[model samples]
Target: MSALILFDFDGTLADTAPDLAAAANRQRTRKGLEPMAYEALRPVASQGARGLLRVALGLRPGDPDYEPTRLQFLEDYAAGSTVHSKLFPGIEALLSDIRRRGLSWGIVTNKVTYLTLPIVEYLDLTRESAVLVCGDTTAHSKPHPLPLQHAAREAGFSVERCVYVGDDLRDIQAAHAAGMPAVAAAYGYVGEDDNITTWEAETCAHSSTELWSAIEPLLPSDLR
Candidate 1:
């Protein structure tokens, strides 16, 4: 079977933090709070709504207003899905490299279909990605193995033939659980406290360029 490259949507494959942070800041503004700086909200971008709400409004899942805040955040994010979103630098080259090798790539994200679909379409990735497993696509999300396993299966790869790349610790955890090698995208929304190297990924890439270099050696001889 061909090797499959599965990437996390928000941070690894694409930089969606600017828009996600804006959505969180919008929520803060509605509550009479000041807008948070993009850098301040960036690290939480990988965590989705839960992280954004906490950073901007200090709301947790159990809070009475949390659900309303979350709904609003989703609405705000959708309205500006493409504002500052773009594939990470060097990613285009990396993807082209993968395509030239005749291998396959897909996305497995905690982003729900509502959010994931628009970004995927906006970025024109719909045609190129062989398979997509959104947050809601499976009953469980990462750090559960289900999403990665589901995407790999859809991509016609055994878990052992897959390599999952992401910016979060959960990504590595899930990859290991699914018996796939994990590559950490340290260039992405890594938290201030996160030690990317400690996640025990097969490799840690500090930038898109580094990521490609790190992953290239891992591909089998035929694909390389």
Candidate 2:
């Protein structure tokens, strides 16, 4: 049997924080808000634009300007989508290794379908992904079992045979909630104050190489 691997797109499989931060800055500049550095934005990259806008522009969700700022951020992000987005180092090697081992991998993300499709295409990863689940594909997103369960169903695997790898607390929560094992991606944009050790996961991988190593032991015997 082939073990199913589900990955998060933004911070886990791709280094999209820079481009996201740039978009945030663009919106901030337009709003006369201070431009925040990419480093400062990295930790909140997986939280989506609302969280980022709040962090960068000091706007709360209930604020009257929040929606306008979010819309502006979306426009800015769309304009700069491919400018600085790229896969993390050694990711290609890790994917190749998985292919070589005959394991199937998929992506489950809370990112909107429009942005997710283009980014996957831009990275030349569409052909490589066995399954792709976007935020709006179903009624619920991550932290809800719907997305991961949906991915497993589409990939023809039992949830128990799958492992979901992601960079955020919600990822682990969702995977576990879905009855699947989880892997925490340590190299992702998690903050210094974040408690990775508290996240419930089968294992943690600090880099692409380490991820591959950790995954190797879990590969189905058929592949070995």
Candidate 3:
């Protein structure tokens, strides 16, 4: 077992916003509603269908149409998984550096496996990641710590030696709840209302270079 660096997929590791925004717009078109601007949907991309539904369709969980619309949104998203999904700048180099440092890294995401696995494969990370844990991998997901804990266990890392990096507030909550440190990816899809500075993260990486600097020290020096 070694020190582990785990990431949330959507905004943190990969920029899936383009495809998500497209899916949201597709839903709007189906509903005969005007498409929402991409800028408006980008911030909520990390929140998945619920967020998109709220923004593009204005459908809340309380509405009868919420569940069906959410399902349709997911369906549309799955159909366009890799169309515009790509890792953020410097991510490939970061992964290479992590490998060179002899540390282990993986993805722990709220995205379901059916949707996430294909994207991971398309990104050619299926062979690179030490482990890949999705929303359904455990009984519960983020904020409950099950997903992060599952990733650590599967990756053969100790809770104390694990660091979770993510773009959303729930990521910080989950890592801390699991007794692990969390790094906030400030360069990611941080919403207009979110305050990364106050997320109680170990550190907030405002850019990929900053992320590398912040993460390098958290990794065991021996591994580096």
Candidate 4:
């Protein structure tokens, strides 16, 4: 089977922080609170509503307002998900190179299907991706091996022939659990306090420009 490269959607494959930050800011505005700075919110974009809400309003899941707020945040985000979202710089060329090398690529993300589908379609990735596995696609999400494992099966690849790239620590953990090499996207929404080196990925790409070099070494020798 062909070698497969799986990427995490938000932060990794796409710069989705602008829209996500806007959604969180909208929540603050409605409550007479000032919007937080984009820089403050950007780092937590990979965490989705949970992280955004916490930073935006000091709210947590068990709080009474958290559930409703989370739902509204998602609704607001879904409406503007693609307004500023786009492939990271050099990502298009990276994908092209992967395709030219006969490697299959797909997305495995914690984003639920409804949210992910629209953005994928907007970005014109719907037809090109060999597989699209979302948070709801499997029994468990990242940090759990099911989603990555499922993507491998759907794309007709063995775990050994797959490499997963993402911007979150959980992504590396999931890849490890699935027996796949992992590449960390350091240029993505990594938290200010996070140390990329501590993620223990096979390699860390500091920017989209560096991704290919970081990934090349992880590929099977035959594929290289």
The residue-by-residue lDDT of candidate 1 on 1-224, one tens digit each, is 47888999889989999999999999988989889889999999999999999988889999999998999999999999899999998888888778777888999998899888988998888888889999999999999999999998888888877788999999999999999888999999998899877899999888878877788666666666
Q: What are the per-model numbers of colliding residue pairs?
A: 0, 0, 0, 0
**Which residues of candidate 3, in runs, are more than 4 Å off?**
221-224
Report how far off residue 139 is in candidate 1 (Å): 1.1
TM-score ranking, high to low: 4, 1, 3, 2
RMSD of each: 1.2, 1.4, 1.3, 0.8
TM-score of each: 0.96, 0.95, 0.96, 0.98
- CA shift of 100, model 3, Å: 0.8
C-alpha lDDT of candidate 3 relative to the true structure: 0.89
**Which structure among the candidates has the greatest lDDT?**
4
Best-fitting candidate, scored by TM-score = 4
Error of 1 at 132 (Å): 0.7
Candidate 4: how large is its RMSD?
0.8
TM-score of 3: 0.96
Candidate 2's error at 99, in angstroms?
Answer: 1.5
Compared with the true structure, all predictions reach lDDT values of: 0.89, 0.87, 0.89, 0.94
